[model samples]
Target: MKLIVTCLFSVIMVYSTIAQNVAISDDGTYTADNSAMLDVKSTSKGLLIPRLNSFEKDNIPLPAHGLLIYQTDGEEGFYYNNGTPSAPEWITFTDESNALWRKDPNKNVTYLSGNSDSIGIGTDSPSARLSTDGMIEAMSDGYKFPDGSVQATAVFPANFSGYESAADRRWVIAMCADEIPGSWEYQGFEECSKVIDLEWGIYVPYEPGGGGVTGNRVHKPITVIKNIDKATVRYIQELVEGQGINEIEFHFFWINPDTQQKQVYYVITIGDVKVIDFNHDVTHVGNEIFSHVDIISFAYEIIHWNWLPDGIEFQDNAIGP
Candidate 1:
């Protein structure tokens, strides 16, 4: 109480006597600068500001606008209230408007320091040098495994650039086609019987003209043959244009409901030649070919709609040497 009274008395006396800018200094030669309201000059010592935690800082009664304070807890930094005394908004001095990488207060796990430190993503207590509890996606520069094995984002053979294999083609086809739930047979062509048996392939009826018989009602299969054909043709074009050798051996068959006979279609590229051999002998139609590209085309447009490119047999049977 005595100390407070003495300090208040001293301030009153100093205000009464000094009409000019106030200067607090130990040296006799030091004088107050014209621009400054109060300047405290020190050589060895430093001026100590009021330090408070986030809770204590908030509790400060009627905090004036532009009130400077040093926050000692949470994201520790010098803070200044930019808002009015009625509604104060404390802003950190370190937060730059133009900074690319800024501290996010909402995220509690990110830890940064001056020294060599471990970075933890989605985790506070990191175990390794760089630990992450979530999936680490590598976009451009591919990441490495714990065993030091590198996994690139895109992997392609040196000779076959942008050349997707039969498996990739099948995957694309499967992805584009309508998915049959559970087993492959639910209202689709998977339950259909194979019409013909080749050395390395089996021709399955994708669309048997109309729907197949199931119990009382006839379940119609989703006609994805056209989509499958377009995808297959596009894949073939890509393979041929990329100068990659095609090793695809697949059959698409259309069954006639009248005679129970099947019209077969063979699609495979040996070197650069895209072969779509249509078995017209079953229909007694002559073998007529169309200009597929400048290189290859098909004449039997009716059979093109019946193609169902599925379960491709990846055989080493190349037509040319």
Candidate 2:
């Protein structure tokens, strides 16, 4: 009885030690590591995990989030659990030369596809090089805003050349440069008092070397682009055939719908030289008044030369006596 009771005590101690950790050895010895619950040590063969066919894998019982297994039949590869404990799903992490690649279940609704030339968004089969089902945005507003209404002011620069001389003037006619002849209200005409924005300037014409070495003064006329833009200015001369100044071809006036005002476009092509205009304005005005040149004289009379010849110049300064 003492021997039997001693044997039972030894068996109990052995089981208690095995409960903490269990290790299997090829030499038929059970060894355990201090940190791990179970460890297998072998030199001949490796441990084979449970292999499953597609049908058998689908029939798994309750699966946890971190469950792992190896598929044996179709798409033979390793799979991991990407689902919860209740609703578990096995997903292939990676596929080498002998594996398969599947789509993400989360991105099933919106797919992404691309090619060498172009990429497609929200589509699988793209017809064009780069096709997209979403709206696109641009970075420039130069062509977007044809009227230069946003992100830029339409006001033009002051004619510095016009101030060079009282007799010698550089006047830009606005009514001649209209794409379609018409006038609209200022964008914010209500903000101004009864007065409107005036884009007016002065221009006079007289014959050079008329009476003597100086010249002769002719009746200078002031032309403006009012409502209909039919006004005319005539400066008749005796030396040459006097023609109607209103008949001179220029661009007509135009109005911008955004500002609801007449856009002040300058005279670009006056016979030959096309003037590049950088000025625009939207000043409110009720009417443009036209008046005659009051102080007319033969002394230093201004010549009405629209454009100079190729070699000749307008303001050629050469230090004369």
Each candidate structure's TM-score, on Cα atoms with residue i matched to residue i, is 0.32, 0.27
Q: Which parts of model 1 are misplaced by more than 4 Å?
A: 1-19, 95-98, 103-321
lDDT (Cα, tens digit) per residue for candidate 1, span 112-203 = 44344667777888876667664344577453447322221122222331222232221111111111111112122332211111222223
Cα lDDT tens digits, model 2, 133-171, are: 542434553224353223211222233222121222212
Worst 10 residues of 1 by lDDT: 170-179
What TM-score does candidate 2 get on C-alpha atoms? 0.27
Per-candidate Cα lDDT values, in order, are 0.42, 0.39
State how far residue 255 of model 2 sits from its true place (Å).
Answer: 43
